[model samples]
Target: MSISRLSSALVASLLLFGAACGDDTVGTSPNNMTTPPGVDVPIPMGSKLQHTGQCAGQVNCQVDVTFNSSAPLQVRVIDGNGAPVVGAAVRYELSVGLAVGTSLNAASAQTNSDGVAQVEIRAGQATGAAEVIVSLPGDTSVAPIKFVAGVQPKDSASYSVTFEHAGTASLRDIKVFLYKAEDSCDAIREDIARERDDDASTNPVLTAEYTANGVASVDGTLPLVVFPGLSNGQSFNVAAQAMSRDDGEVELAFGCTDSNPPIENGNSVNVIVRLEDHLPRLKGSFDVTHTFSITDAICDPQPNGGYAGVLPSGVCLAIDLIGRLATDPASFILGEGSGDTGIIGLIVDFLPDDGILGTLKGAIESFLGNSLIQNLGRDALNEFFATWIENNAPDWVKGGIDITADIYESLQEFRVNGIIRIEREPDPTLDTETNTVVGLLNADQDGNRPGKQVWEDIIVYWTGDCASSAPAACRERTFSATDLGATSSVVEGSFTGTVVPLTGEGETGFGLIINEHTLALNYGVLILGIIEQVVLPSIFGPTVTSLEAALNELLLLVLPGGTTGCQGFADFMVDNIGSSVETIARNLCESLLESASDGIREFLTENLTISGEDNFLLATPTGTPCKLVEPEAYTGAWIGKPLPYIDGLGTDSMLCEWDVKIRISQDTIIETDGTFSGNRTGF
Candidate 1:
């Protein structure tokens, strides 16, 4: 009678087959069964539930689904006899929650041969919980099962990072910058460019500083990078950099937002980056040091050349006179190859060769013959000597003689003191600048014209007796000279020149030339006395002095082949001795110039370096940085002493001493004390 029960005819059929009915089927068991009442029979289907995909975790009674996401809901249909109902129909229904917008594809579907029917449950864009039910169409014996699903905001996340090096974790006082995916253009471009051997340029989106060692934090003080509005499956790139305090070098890190715990759909993610340094760093300063020596090749007082006493040849008398007269004070010794040695070494070493003295002698002779001594012509000189011979009454003197004899000597003490300063121009070009450094020799800063007066405060002291006690040639002590005072004197003029950089291919070079300059000697007391008293009377004595007249007449008794009168002897001695001192002073100036320009070049070329972390020079790929610092200014001072400059190799060689100080600044030199001194032995 009840529609839910199986019919008697069906029961008769079941009895004939000895089948049984059970409650495991879609509805209650059939009304009739051939088996015993307690017997349980097979059932092809049950009221149990199951699901696939996003809805798999849903309760069997109430399957849930996500918004805008699709999933399958299935149920099996069978007969009370536990056999599948080939064409049975199943009903489906959806119950959407209050904030959800979604629905099922169909409310009903026919069961397949396996007694199963599936309906796809699709969700809407809105987020909220939803439910689905599955059951037999008209049979109320079995309860419908329900499944639930939910749609929430998409997954999104964020990250924080720190840097480290050589196991040291602290990254103090370094700058950090973060760039978004779009803003990471600089990082990507640089990466590609570096691959092609090109230079890289940087660009950043946001920046922050790290004060803690090794740690860059993203907290309340520093906000973490957030991707707040990303939907499912979307992502972006990220780049960051940490830089040195001095801006000398940098380190970089890169990442992607698409990584797990992904930035998409309200999800959050965290990242950490460790950096390694590869770029070169910038430098601040560098330095170089040099030591120089002094030698007798240029400083020797003996014009005769080579060591004294070793050779049989005697010393030159003219050299001895000039050397002793040009004394360098003991307080300021200029050239000290060895500590406290003397200016004789300094002045002489800086001067030219003895051969140059010969040239100066010719020059002086020309000047005297044409100007100062013009009053005494050759014929007059002959007549004067002839008169002396007539009055003296010597048979050998009846014929006039040639008064030309070689007078060789060595100086007891030759002294010179001066200031050598180096300076650089304000605007120096690269390698091509001319006269960038202006050299002032003994420059005067206090006079009417500052930096214009040169060769100032020069001292040439001569205080020694000349002429041997024995009579080798003329009468003994007849033409003797003594006690040239030790008073100091200065040259009247100055020397100005320019220093040029002789830069060659990959090496440092130097050059210098005196542009507009002059060093004029203002012969003071000693020189004037020698010219007027000693020289004037020594060779032309018979004609000009009674003391020499008697001696000249007595010379014939000693031997033959000698000058009865002072014919040409005065000119010869004056020419050789007088001209020699001039050349010596000039040569000394040249030596000072060479020391400055050449010394600077050699020091830089051999010693400059750029990168290693110390006082010694460190080299870089570019070049040695020390070479880049140009000379700015210079200041110098010197004091002479009585200590003689003696050679370590020979006991006979000796000269005056000087203590000199030359302070040079690369930018500008200010003379706190404009002290200068000059000494000259002139005709």
Candidate 2:
């Protein structure tokens, strides 16, 4: 049999069931047929026509008539003397507006010996109200009898949605929407966007909102969601979002009923939707502000007036030797020399014997190390010092100098800034059954996907003479590694890592695992610049000049005869020796700065990298699960290991830490509703 015929037969069986269950008044017309006054016809006296059977008085009654079902209509005709009018014929006709295929089982039917005539009013696949007309054939005495029936789809059912949240946050409200089974999740998302935007024209098949009070369910059920015009075996999809507020911040979670079961006749299905932290809702860029301090105990003051901890032991030894030679020139001289009997010859001969040359050279070697001294060779350094003594020895003797006592009392400040971009993976690993996702993270300089990029700047301010009213007397300088210049600008770097879903203690969220990342800044060159431009000029220059003046004064007092000439000779030797020593120390210190900078960079990188799992609860305000507005701000702190000493010089080092604050905002707004006005405030 054809599908339409089979449907008709099934509907017919349902109608029979309705009749057997005493529901025959369903789909019945209210009033019976009556003869019109204008009709001119000859009728037998006392003859009457009326509706009979279980479907009587069912005219235009408000009731549902299942599609392809028939409504049985029975009528009786009697003669004038109240006797049965056997063999009388009755006709039936359906008015327009009824679906096509709505018809009578028989156009005409003869009355039986009991004076009864019957016909069936069948419905069609569409929904609308139509009247069925009954009349005696070829007789104008009785006007047409009308019976109304409303056609509707079969197997239509309502749905009761139940929301579930595993987190501790109190749910404020849940919005649910239904779509056709063939519609993709993206399409449903677009519809949701329309609703969120308050678009009046866009409508879903079914929508419901449930308000909660510290719970997602009320009496284990919410409002029933009904979709009209649904037939048996037709499926649909359900999309819902639950919203909660905590500490003045809004949080949103999503759930979907994918591959929903088909509708069954007269069934009220219960659908359970569990909310979770989906990646798409959390995708965006965040601006982070961090403040951290790097302190070295070696820089701190000691009980002794001398800074024994500030400079390396080797450097301290070389400085002390030079100081002794300045205060007592007679003791430094070993013996007289042949080619040049002047103070310069005596000093040169005294250097190798007193082991001052070896001591200074050893200090320089220790300061620079092998890796840093590769370009500045030791042979070249010795040659330069020897050549300096033979030429331009008297110029350094005339200058007077003073060393700043509070040279080490200065403060160093570091400023850092960055953006953290979160995006969906091209091929994300997900478990639909558990609603879990394994998200990947990496440092892509191209600014794509989930990654972190940072920029940093360093500044130094001398605390000496801060009590002076003049600000210029208090020295300050900013250093940048990028161009090796004094500028207050940040240099860029990146961090590498991964974020994975975490579940424990009945709570779920994401955990950030940052790999050991090396900063892109050139710490060696940066430190080298600071040492050459600031340290050498401000501190070492004065120390060298002071030593030269002291040695000249000492020579005048110690020489036996011809004090004037001896003083001049002493001046030349001290001047040449002091200038040469200063130059060599500067060069060695420069190389040392480079080597130390490398170590500093390594230590800073290790301390800066976050250790262990930075576990954040999914439902908490600080967690990764969050709704992205046009602009969102978050505040937190990143604690790291204590700062380590250079060459293990100090007992304890201050912690290397950062107080992080972030502001997340979007520049481009994507409208899923197809109206790309670009003014959306939130997702």
Candidate 3:
């Protein structure tokens, strides 16, 4: 063999044998110590390294900066094909927003022999994340690190709201709602739409229900809100609503969401609205100083003689007349929103609870020019007429009519032929004291509106022969009201004596003694009082228990529960004997029963448990205190506690709660709000 050939062959054989013995692949492999087949080693841009920490439960990761460099820089670590190379360079440049140290010129120490390195972060360094690059000569082992520093735990806030009128207000249709403030933060961006749904739709929306006593209410905790991209100055608004089935008196307030609904909650403010309003029932704006006309058939200047200037001391009827004037239906509805009114000479329907009008008695004794015949004094009757005008007439109606005292007539035609309709106004100002309409009636302007009185007196004088000489002057004042003021027409009845001019001009001139107008008042109320004062036991044959409930409600306002007031109220009801009072008591009894049922239901549903999912994770330079970060680079891991769950329960599990449901019905209807009486028909 040749010497040269022998040496070359021996060297080639040795090289091949050494490669086969090591088991190290030439190309990159997952566990390969050298560069992998396809992966390239990264190059470093700077000398400092920065990083932040995060866990699986996080929706966001902190980008806190640890070490910083003044000039453009980079960070890197050495790695083979699959793992971190022990000697690669990683660096980055820092800006004010990304500054972790006072000086950007700071740098981190080089890696150890195995390629591990950590930079020292300065104290009082601003928090933020800085982008870093990994530089390597044709070897890309380390990926770019999403570096961050300075993590903090945040605090949260919660709210709650309730209503003031949830229990005993006259008008009880009110709704209240709350909303979480929308913000500009990326993590909570979708919360805005979710909040709207939570407040308006599938709401944990609190609500009030109607009971016989009407004591149900709404209240609860409100969730927190965050803005998308916002850093400061966050707030919210709350809205309130008033509702009604029939128009009932209701009041509202705006402030903060609280038990009172009047006080303010930290984040929520209130806006109140009234659904029903009932006030100012009666109205009068004009001066009523004028004297009303006094109608009398005996005032004729004929055979019977009486002195002038002084009206007889007899009770009399003031000759005043009016029509059903309708200018504003919203304010005045004769037979509509009003209660029962006695016959006003019109085809008006009466409501079930309305009162009747006064009775019509003798008009002759009133204007007979003798005080002896009048049941009420003539001065009293006259005063009543004027006072009614002053108190009940509108400001415009005072100057409408023209008349004199010489007209001799009877005010009966209106009643005989239904020309006037009288309906009672609604009494919303129920006296918590008397429980009557006395004070409320004073505020009623609906029954009688402005511009109603057109004529001073509705005289129906006798439509007899003008040339007749018969001696029947007593039956003379009888005629249709339409015939008045017809020029040159035959007079309904002849005025016998001399004519006189009345001074001061307030329906006072003498021509002929004629027509008069008459109206009915609500005397039934007085009659009831009389009956109650007179025969007590007969009217309330049932025991006091039948009427106790009504008296109890009244006492509730004036008297407190379980006190002397309550006892006095109970005794008062037992002592009283009136059918009307008994009826009121019956209604109150039903209400009490309803209230008792509601209290039971409230006790049954005291607390509840809810279930929800919280799943999230963070991706970054893989530095985590939870020990989830892997030793190698370019992968993900977990460093958090396991998700919270019900003890001994599986992943797909629910809380089982046991409660005794107190129901108003034999069985209840289960709804999202809770249970309701299944038989609403009975309710």
Best TM-score among the predictions, by candidate number: 2
Report backbone clashes per prediction.
83, 7, 87
Task: Point out where model 3 deviates above 4 Å.
Answer: 1-169, 178-234, 245-304, 307-483, 486-683
Using TM-score, rank the candidates from best to worst. 2, 1, 3
lDDT accuracy of residue 288 in candidate 3 = 13
Q: What is the C-alpha RMSD of each candidate to the true structure, in Å?
A: 30.7, 23.4, 35.3
1 or 2, greater by TM-score? 2
Candidate 1 segments whose C-alpha is farther than 4 A from its true place = 1-154, 164-178, 185-236, 241-325, 328-683
Query: Tens digit of lDDT per residue, candidate 1, span 1-683?
Result: 67546587676554433211122222112222234433333333454332323233332322223445565555555575655554455678776654266777778765555555566667677654455667665565554555443433435222232233211111223333333444344454355334434233433223321111122322101112222223445434433334332221322222222222335444433443333222111111111111111121212334444334211111221222222211211111121112222222323323345577445434433433342223322233334334444554333223322111111111111222333222222121222233122222223454321112222222222212223453433331222122222222333233333323334454322222222332232112223223223332444353533212322332112222453222233333234345433443233323323443343223222222112222111111121111221112212211111101101110112111212111111221111111112221110
All candidates: TM-score: 0.21, 0.38, 0.18
What's the ranking of the predictions by lDDT, best on top? 2, 1, 3
Q: How high is the CA lDDT of each candidate model?
A: 0.31, 0.40, 0.24
| Better candidate by lDDT, 1 or 3 | 1
- Candidate maximizing lDDT: 2
Query: What does the lDDT come to for candidate 1?
Result: 0.31
Candidate 2: how many backbone clashes? 7
Model 3 Cα lDDT, one tens digit per residue, 442-555? 213443321111112222323222223555552233222232211112111111111111222232111111112212211111111112221111112222111123222222
